[model samples]
Target chain A: MPRTSRAVKLAALPDGLPGPEHFSVVDVPVPVPADGEVLVRNRYFQVFPSLRTLIGGGVKGTPFPPLRPGDTLFGAAVGEVVAAPGVAGLRPGDLVRHWLGWREHAVMPAGQCAPLDGTLPDPAAHLGQAGVAYTALARDARVRPGDTVFVSGGGGGVGSLAGQIARLLGADRVVGSTGSPDKAARLVSELGYDAAVVRGGRPIAEQLAEAAPGGIDVLVDNVGGEQLQAAITAARPGARFVLVGTLAGQLAPDRSGTTAPVEIDTFQLIAKRIEMRGFGGLDDAGPRPEWTERVGAWLRSGDLTFPHVRVAGIEHAPRALQELIGGRHLGAVIVEL
Target chain B: MPRTSRAVKLAALPDGLPGPEHFSVVDVPVPVPADGEVLVRNRYFQVFPSLRTLIGGGVKGTPFPPLRPGDTLFGAAVGEVVAAPGVAGLRPGDLVRHWLGWREHAVMPAGQCAPLDGTLPDPAAHLGQAGVAYTALARDARVRPGDTVFVSGGGGGVGSLAGQIARLLGADRVVGSTGSPDKAARLVSELGYDAAVVRGGRPIAEQLAEAAPGGIDVLVDNVGGEQLQAAITAARPGARFVLVGTLAGQLAPDRSGTTAPVEIDTFQLIAKRIEMRGFGGLDDAGPRPEWTERVGAWLRSGDLTFPHVRVAGIEHAPRALQELIGGRHLGAVIVEL
Candidate 1:
């Protein structure tokens, strides 16, 4: 067994869209599993935009551990447990996903590590399709059957999965918005969107009108800005908006101390009777083991697709995250450690 | 019975906030009841901010009928049914409330008018505390026991009642925001609010933080601009914001072609997991007859108070409405015809 494990750590607090200079990977002694713990060799780690909060600053009151210099990055990662001394129901070679990422190893409590289903061919696929998108569509937005759905940032991690989830929840039509025409076309052709519109080409309100002429019944807003206003304008009466991200500011060249203003018209809000809700990640989405299994079965059957940009090694993880933030990548960005 | 009834008519569509010059009272022959209809002698009519929507312009797709010049203005009013013809369960001298208001007489189907209990001394009180505030609190916001509630524009009709209603619903604390210092003091002293903060003097966010140091669990936002931002900042995780009005723009000297921007921060929305819902009045609130009766009982018992500006005569109705639009009147504005 290798005595050393390489882990990614914050080099410095970020000033803007993060770069490789903000992170460092160092060799360290692999953590030894104490009582009731298992040593995990992390195979793959996920990256997304919201990690900036943990990396750059801290929320006043949140359960998420704030990232600091020399501290290993934290996120969802899939790994194989190499050692589980005296821990029942857990054994060596068992593939598990846990809340520790951007590292070669993790020593987690045995019961805390959820066993990953080996149904899908690629183990990394287990890391990308977490519960947030499904929870937003089914629980938060309540994307009912025969509903017309619109998703902003439809090519991003949550948006990509949310469109398919909306369909699986019985949405009649799924329309998406993307930043580039190429991504717009890809959203429809590859991501199961019935139609897609480019964000910048025309006013989103104008373009959304043509895409969903009857107006959207459910909106999964991953990019908030003018897009949020356009969604409010195009929303059918009693439409539900599940806001998951603000990638508009995430794409900025420098967003040091500035905040993204999500403007909505009060008249339209009242007239449309819109319901807007925001949700955090898996923790906020209560444990839905049956629902998760159903989703897993669909994935295994090729009914649902998990789209992601895969990087070859841990060294490329920070750059991949930077590129993902800059809108250079599509869908979930993950590194195979 | 008088053969002719004097009614307030819109002389012109509002150029700005509206004035007496834009309205005229005309005498017209009272129509005789036909079929199952009754001729109502409207004793009092209520005028508030949202009535401007029906009076000034049109909402493309809504049940609310548009107002035009030479037409009697429409709103909630309480009146004694003079003649019910052959209609059963309704009789003359029975006080009832209906949607047709700002008039001295109304011809309506007997079944359409809801009976007003004589328990509360002022029948005009029923015209003001309609089902919107009740519905917004109970169903939309789901304000629960021991929750901290915050209300913006707490001096206005819905806002005034919402603060008291929050307490009755078992809220641990109820805080309110108003435009003036006097209204702020009156919110706690007269309106059953636990605490009140004036909007303009100190930053609302700062005052709100002091008022609700633990943060607010529910927000009934009647004023939308800066107050909305303050409420969002002071919101607790899983807070629900029930949006009932946009009176911030209603106080504007001239809002001819402008729209009120409701600004929200996406990060706070996600981190806090806030749910925001907007509702129209009365019809959208659905019929809550039993709850209305309960609220009426509360008023009669001195537990809930209905505060309103009472205009003595129909001739002053237009001026009263103008004052309401200008934010000069507190609670409801009702005119005794």
Candidate 2:
């Protein structure tokens, strides 16, 4: 058993996108599992979009509290149980998915650490698809069969996997909007999206009109500024827009209500009978078993692609998160602990 | 009956809010009713908010086509059937409601005119309520009993009656937002609104926080600019916001997308899970009979108050509409011919 472990603690709250200076990776004595708990050696942790909101404080509507200085950051992690006491169904060498990430090891109640049967070869793959993506598109937005789905920030963590999940959920056509031209190209070419609209090139409404001529039925929106407004304009009557994130606020130069305000023409809003909702799946405690089983089958059979950029070592998790925020990486950024 | 009647036609599409110069009243010979048709002497017509959009051009998502330069305006009008031929329920002097207003007389298909039983005193009362407000709050938002409701454009037509309707529909408390302080005070005192927030006096979000303190459960929004944004900010999680109008857009100085845009902080949107849908009740063909019966009962029993501003003649309707658009009057604006 390892005698010591490491954890990434919130060194400081950042004014903008966080970097290594904002996080302090420190050595600590490893915690052992108590009664009904299991000691997990975390194999891989995800550097997702919510991390940007997490380090700044916390997102509203989510149950997770903000990390104070010296507090270990929390997120999704796939790990192997090294020790268990009085825990049923969980044993040593069993792969599990749980919160308490940003740490080399986590001591969690067996109930919180959901076991992953050997359906997929990579433990990191378990961190990618099961819960957040499923909840946003299938459960929340209810992406109907033959529905046209539009996802903003298609290169980011949840958004990257969301397009694929939407398609698997029976979306007839998927169009993604990305700030990066390369990411836009890759989204259409590799991620099974029918088309991709690059932001900053032209008016998104003009582009989306050409991309999805029938108008988008469902929108899994990650960036929520001009993109959201454009999506609203291009949405068909009775369309469902699932607001997954607000990168526009994060990427804003000013917080004075002057930057990138999504000006929705209310006349259009009522006329179309559009429905929009916010998602807080990342803060959820458990993954849906049905999603894991379904997604795993798809991944293993080569029907789905989970393009991930995996970084080595827990010490680099903070940097991985920064890269994810900067839109440097396309798809999920997995940090191997 | 007069051998000739006066009808108002669109003179020219106004660049902004239309005035007397934008309309021309022309004399036309009254036509006899054909088979299965009724000749109605128009008693009253509504000079409501939709008239603003109608005069500018038809609203999107509604079936109502735009009025050309010479086309006579169409709207909700309550009239007395002077002649009926080969029609069931045949009677002269029977009060009925139908489209084809802005004229002294109309020859409508017998099926088009819905008869209104003498549930209330005035024939014009039928024109005031029974459709738009009921559909917006009760049907669209589904304002539950014990729910706190917030309404924008409280002094305007639909908004003025909507508060009373929401309260009658079992809303625990009703709060309204208006630009005029006098209107706000009247909304609380004369109308059924529990509290009234004056826009342009304080930040709407701060006022709403004080008004509904518990957070708004339902929002029947008419003016969709800063007030809508404020309502979104102050909304309780899982609140339902019904989009009723875009008076802000109507009142904006420029149509270049630079004015009065509702900057929705989408982070707050998802966190609150606020659900909003558009209301197209005004453009609908018929008044719901159930609403008329229920509202008539409410009005007669003194359980509901239908506040209205009346103009004497149809010739002055164009001016009444201008006054209504300029916020010179409160509640429903009715033009008696």
Candidate 3:
């Protein structure tokens, strides 16, 4: 007998804030595995800010297709395989994490699903948040020990993991900027950040000066515009300013009131010889079999830890997304069916 | 009998535009060279825009001491050595070039002066404009063959030589921006620029699009502000934007009738992987003895030609500066005494 599954589908495009009306739950037949494919019954789904951007008409200059009405909201998920289609190594009843959608059941190519090592405390750790964030922070930032790393929006899913990863990588000092004082405290006490500052209340430069005192060496900026400018001003000579988001605003405001476009003094760069870079998540890059092996080892060895996940049902994914958009949540918001 | 020399000395700090009142010419007894010092009779002095910025108190956070009232006005210059203080390989009546000052005579350490080979058409070529500009263009910009190079302020001293050096480096296409159509015509016809666009008239992106068609790979910018923004917009992925000057105004005006601080989009950097670097002439870190040797070789071999220079007497130094400040001259303005 074929199994039935509940899935979250994009009901409509969101304007400013995503609501329950923007998503709808529907029942669908579990997909059957085709050649070189595996059948997975998803247990956990990942919700993130990029999803918000995606639902709002997608990122500019993106070459991929955009999410449309009635389409199942796509994301990476953790599931258990009931059957495999002509694939070796992967067997029935294996817990796996794969890139699929919000559906309770998914049929993906065998290459997409990686067998979750039983050694991990929770298989969902590999699927939703910890996996992508850790891989991105490690590979893209090239985090190292004795380096001073600053994470903007530190309370968010990626920022929280990035801070932890920085600490695990031997960062001598880890500073974070969050939207609230509670988030700031959590970032410090719970996430191993050396210091945390509340954003928007005070001048970021002044706050950073109090936090780091000796200028930041590596700034992982997810909040752009004014925050980015403050970070730039607070950066030490030869610092690296990495842009990961522009949540604050697209353009930096002119404080001097000259009505002129911001003219970055190239001399700052000349004097300090700083390098600025940007990075997106690693989902686009094909599965790094070694990443799984290594992160799995780290997870098993207790060298890395996963953040507390807020789980919701598939029907409540829209509420979870709304919470993420409102910046009310501190960790990964995962939806389960 | 004591020898007499004329020197221009800084009088007082001016509020904005420096004038003849800010400088005083006085006669002094030329002193004999001490051990490790060489006495040179000055020939040519270079008037640069950086001097203007310095005089206007525009640069901030610089390590060097600011100009003091009644201090000698020093800059890059060329002269003939009349006395060598116990120095080997240098003799009286030998023409040399050193960053001395705007004076009729100067006594610098023997280690500072480099003996100029007489093969050049004019010894003033080393002192006037060729050295700093060519060294900056060759070593800093790293101009290579087949690169599409864009030069701003092509009618000025550094821009002219930068264009010539780009050509000498075998750049496949070279475009320049000038303040006037006459300069643009001169840049295209006489200076061998592939195309020249009038500055402040047309949008730089549109002009660059029409000129290069493909996109600019290397930008040697002398005029900053809006042109810098436009250059960033027109840059090809992985292109280099080199900031060498800020003549087009330092602050960019914004929409709210206020001046916006200059800030680059770190996202654009990630998407395009572009590198924006600043080249501040041959300072301490740049190729020094090797650069002098190589440029000297090029000059001696007649492979690099020097631009025409307008000469003024020592008393006319203030007027020459005025002319430069007013943008009245082309090529280099050299004060020969």
Score chain B of each candidate by TM-score: 0.89, 0.90, 0.85
Segments in model 3 whose C-alpha atoms lie over 4 Å from true places: A1-147, A161-172, A250-263, A280-303, A306-315, A331-337, B1-45, B59-100, B103-147, B154-158, B161-172, B250-264, B280-310, B314-322, B329-337
Best-to-worst lDDT order: 1, 2, 3
Best by lDDT: 1
Query: What is the lDDT for B307 in model 1?
Result: 76
- Docking tier of model 1: it is medium
Name the 10 consecutive residues with the lowest summed lDDT in model 2 chain B: B252-261
Place model 3 in a CAPRI quality band.
acceptable
Ranking by DockQ: 1, 2, 3
Please estimate how well model 2 matches the true structure, expressed as its whole-model Cα lDDT. Answer: 0.79
Q: Of the candidates shown, which would achieve the greatest TM-score relative to the real structure? A: 1
DockQ agreement of candidate 2 with the native complex = 0.41
The TM-score each candidate achieves on chain A is 0.90, 0.89, 0.84
lDDT of 3 at A243: 58
Tens digits of per-residue lDDT, candidate 2, B1-337, equal: 6899999999987877677888999999997999899999998898766666655666544344666689888788999889998898869988888887899999989888788767656677777454678778877788899999999988778888899999989999899988788888889888878999987778888899899898888999888888888888778888888887777766553442212347666766766777777774543344445567677788888887778888998789889877877788878888888
lDDT of 3 by residue, B1-337 (tens): 3488888887887655666888889898896789989999887878765555555543443333456677777777888888897899889888877877688888989878778765455766666355555655666656777788888877677787778778777788989888778778888877778999886688876887798887777788777756666666677766666666665642112111111135555545545545565554464233244445555666678666555556668888877776665666667777888
